[model samples]
Target chain A: MSNLKGWKEIPIGGVIDKPATSRLYKTGEWRVSRPVIDREVCINCMQCWLYCPDMSIEGSIEGKRMKLGEFKMEYCKGCGVCAAVCPVNAIVMKPESEFIDE
Target chain B: MPVKLTVTGAHAVAQAMRQINPDVVAAYPITPQTPVVEYYATFVADGMVDTILVPVESEHSAMSAVVGAAAAGARTMTATAANGLALMIEIVYIAASYRLPIIMPLVNRALSGPLNIHCDHSDAMLARDSGWIQFFTENHQEAYDFTIIATKLAEKENVLLPAMVNLDGFITSHGVESFEMLDDEVVKEFVGTWNPKYSLLDTENPVTFGPVDLFDYYFEHHRQQEEAMNNAYEELPKVFEEFAKISGRKYDFLDLYKTDDADYIMVVMNSTASTAKYVVDELREEGKKVGLIKPQVFTPFPKKEFQKALNGRKGVVILDRAMSFGKEAPLYSLIKSALYEVPSRPKLGSYIYGLGGRNTSPKMIRQAFEDAFNDNLVADEQRYLGLRE
Candidate 1:
């Protein structure tokens, strides 16, 4: 097996040294628009979690004890499932077009 | 003789594709690259060309479909970038090894993580060793012209290798510029019909491709690939000479600009070379004796031509837009090896700039040129362009 330490030096000769930036600003990229939940309308239901195609939705399945709906944008491919499954219409799928006019 | 219209680099490439009139195209949708296929869809929808456009679910399937189409004696083409090309990796090797002569436009983009979908050469860098003849276009005009030449070069009987034509992701893909598009009849005559000796669908004779090469014949398959790559050195110029006769734009594997008497030079590829050209012009105006060397054909990398351009140059600076994960930037290592063959080589080093859509400005190019002039300064890390800390 090759030593992993020399591998770091390899990219050093190749890697573009990145200037520091706020984590949030650094993460800005062209991403699929996804949905967020309104805590008021969520009733500890897991309908969106069951229907996600990429298994992007992550939340608890506890019965009536935990917060019903919450999803991380990191893994979400913006398939708009949470908004589509919200019984109270609390979830809204804002298309990425709103933020990026392009 | 020339008609000019403003169009995006993707549209320019699509215009060239329509002109060449390939029999089949299998393309997939990916960020920054979706525009190329989208415009081709418009061309097909408008009934401008009679071509089979296969809408594939994934890049792998897209390449597989093109491989099938090309093997059946059809001139086939495809477009993808970054993760899309990564997805097509397995079949890309198969296409080159099989000598199917499929031409693909790689709208180069950064690979994911914190998940970026913008411009970078990460995808192309990862693919350098994949046995395909790669070419990098620095502008919309070359992006359009190279596609026509690529079809002829890849289809040549002596050099039957898949060609990867790379354009900067968001920069060239979406950047609109005026380009001179060749007429359909001219391009059709330039490329001609792709006549392959061994085709899967040939009714006259049946042959098995992608056969199980049980170690005995596997090395021969790779040997054939190597031979084909070497043959590309002659085949590229032949096709380019033919293209120049019709299009009037002569091309070489490596384009030398003002390097005849310069002591120092900067080498680059892709769209960033356009900015480097501007820097070269400004430096020349100040009598600083700077020039830019850009590569039009990457794989079967024009070793002889590259060394000639570096001749008499005291120091050489290679600018690569992509970073190899566990090695020196692909361009740096490749240039180092190329220089090794020369008798009196220049001081060679590299600078990696513009990953993840970072703007590579002319100002940065000037600074890099100035840095290369200093003998005392040994730059440790690759220079980051447009980084605001």
Candidate 2:
């Protein structure tokens, strides 16, 4: 919270100076839920990566996504779209409080 | 040499638009404002200016097209009235939020229910909080000048925001008055060309506009928009001064006529101010010190200027062409807030008149002044000038 820029420091007109800077804005701080992946049950079908609106699902880009990958927690907005799209029930939405570090 | 032409307020605005020759004009016509787009489209059709005139389906599309066009780094403009302005107002906020300097000429008319096409300011008042610089013109001449000035002001580096140049519905929009139009070359050079700091077309330095800004940053962006209004209030005079150099018509936040030594000052807006000034003359002939303060710039509200202008007066009467429904009239409420911190404030009275083009005759104006100087004014004396019981 202390590090966030004040009104005077931000650019005028809500115009993001460079495209794709949304990656820099962390949305996980107050997100109510987060997606949890069960690696044992996960089939690397890559549906979550393709369906993620925030593009928070991260994995290898060799066209196969053969192994499970880490979540880009900073950009994830806790929408269950990625979880809902998983072909196997490997990804699930959980209360962010369960994983939040004190 | 200035061209001498007798033209309606709408045509005068079009003549200025033709001179501005903005990159794009997307407009859907409404009465009183129809002639403005009609004339500008003809200019575009005739190759008078290299402008793309997009005849849109509705006022909503009209504003949407201009917003998209302006965002694409094109100098853009549009015109609408009353319900048309109402239709476009949602995108109008977006236009300001993105800080696109689109110039819109608003033909003031009453918002509907008892739908009638005539002069009143309820239309413009609807946009008071929409984050655009607002200029109210008293007649056709001002309609012409402000259209050109708005182009320069809206795109002024410090104030990159949309602006509305307002003319009373049919009274000013359809009123034909001869005004000296600036030579085309002079105006072209005066406004110069738009060199924006950020543009949608600047592919080299790619930028994003109208992003899904959330709480973490939305406040900062909206705060920036809010502060731009202050930047505009400060930059307006310099822009007006520059226009004055080109057109020889000096402008300020308030156009004060015989106000300095008056015991009572009357504040009015749009064409109604002309009537107020005439009554002031009639009263002055018999040695009553009444004067007129017409706000050339209405959106910024010119709070400090109003505080200074109304400080030492014995009394002040505000005439409004629209009502606030639940409050004292619009102009009256603004003047009240402006006077809050003044060291010596005048007694204030509000006289709402001419809603939906009801006639505000000299007789109605006289009644306010006749009562103003009697030293019986309250802090908030709300009265109807010409409404018959």
Candidate 3:
């Protein structure tokens, strides 16, 4: 909280200067499990992208085909709605401690 | 040129609203306060003013709609009393937290339990800590004058807080009085146009209002509001000076009547102040050294001015219309806290008077003052004036 500016420095009326600035809080630390997507079994269906509560998942479209983009770890609060909505079992929620950097 | 007119306090407020001609007015009708909106609605219907009058279904919706309009960068106002104000309590806090600068005329009435509707200070006292600036008016003239002044003060760049001008219900709201009213053009010039520093409608410089402020930033935002309130206290005299230049009617945080060489003093608010003045004059003619301190601005508590006026008095009595129930009355407690540090503070007494529009005459006021003078120094019990056993 000390990192945030003092009362005098903040915008009048508590208005955020930039949209989607909640990403500055690093809410990903609250997540117990992280969602990982399997590209091979992924059927270009944007179900997970649509269901992501934090808008942390971006969809990458090549020409007429759409695929999953990189997950934004900064904003993901570990809500598993995206994993529950994936029809093809392409996305899985894995324990954060068990997962090693690839 | 200012002209004299005989009108109810509610109509005087409506007349002020017409002169201001705000961008929006969202209101619901409650007794006493009903005519204020009714008259404004006629102005809107007859093409007298270019204001979007929203005759909202309830006071809650009225306040909510006004909040939205004010946030959208439109000058807005509303009027309500007692139960209507009670229903709007939730949004009242929201409006102040957002610093919307909305002006409201809160017609004072008794908050009901057994359901009685008349004049009292309970309604205004309920919102005392809601972070809105409050002004208590003695008559229709101050009611009209303060409404316009409240608009300018609320919209000041340094002080973007909501404000409420309180006129006693039925006593002043329904009673007609003749008072000088400023010309429309002169009022328009005095209030001027509202230039919001940041607005929700400013697409080019977008801003978010009423955001979820958690532990990290909520305190800081509250501090900002405190700073704004402090700024309002400092900015009020300047605003009063400017208004006086045009209208020749000066005002201050507190109105002092014969406090210079007085040994006994009475402090009160609203229309009761006028009654106290009559008592004070009569006491003076009989060679009694008594004075009166009528607090005009209730919020920000006007601590400094009150301390200066009350220091070195022999005895002081405070009259409160609302009961704090289980504790000291609101105005009495406020005065005690304010004068706590005064070097030779006066012996203070508290009296609860005129609840539910009980008649408070000059004789009753004089008796209270006499009781305060004769009471023992250490006695601190509250006396209920005119309350039958």
- lDDT: which candidate is best? 3
**Which residue pairs in candidate 2 collide?**
none
TM-score of 3: 0.86
lDDT of 3 by residue, B119-141 (tens): 89999999998989999999999
* Model 2 docking tier (incorrect/acceptable/medium/high): medium
Write one digit per residue (lDDT tens) for candidate 1, span B1-389: 56796989999998888887788999889988898889898889899988899999999999999988887778899999999999999999888877788889999989886588888888987788888889899989999998888888887776888998999987888988999987778788888877875766765565556644433345556666777788888787877888889978999888888888788888999888888988998999998888889999889888788877886577888888888766777887788788777888887767878888888888888777887778522433455556676
lDDT tens string, model 2, B1-389? 99899988888999999999999999997987899999898899899999999999999999999888887889999999999999988999999988999999999888895988888889999999999999999998899999988888889877899999999988888888898999999999988998877878899999787888777787887788878888998888888889889888998899999997999999999899899899999999989998999999998888889999999788999888888888888889989998988988888888888988999999999888877878767766688888988
The model with the greater DockQ, 1 or 2, is 2
Clash count, one per candidate: 1, 0, 0
Residue-level error in angstroms, candidate 2, position B84: 0.3
In terms of lDDT, the poorest run of 10 residues in model 2 chain B is B373-382
Give me the runs in candidate 3 sitting further than 4 Å from their true place.
A20-22, A28-102, B376-379
- For candidate 3, the per-residue lDDT at B301 reads 84
lDDT tens per residue, model 2, A10-98: 77888888877755778777778999889899888888988889778777766644555788888888989988988888988999889
lDDT of each: 0.79, 0.88, 0.89
The candidate maximizing DockQ is 2
lDDT winner between candidates 1 and 2 = 2
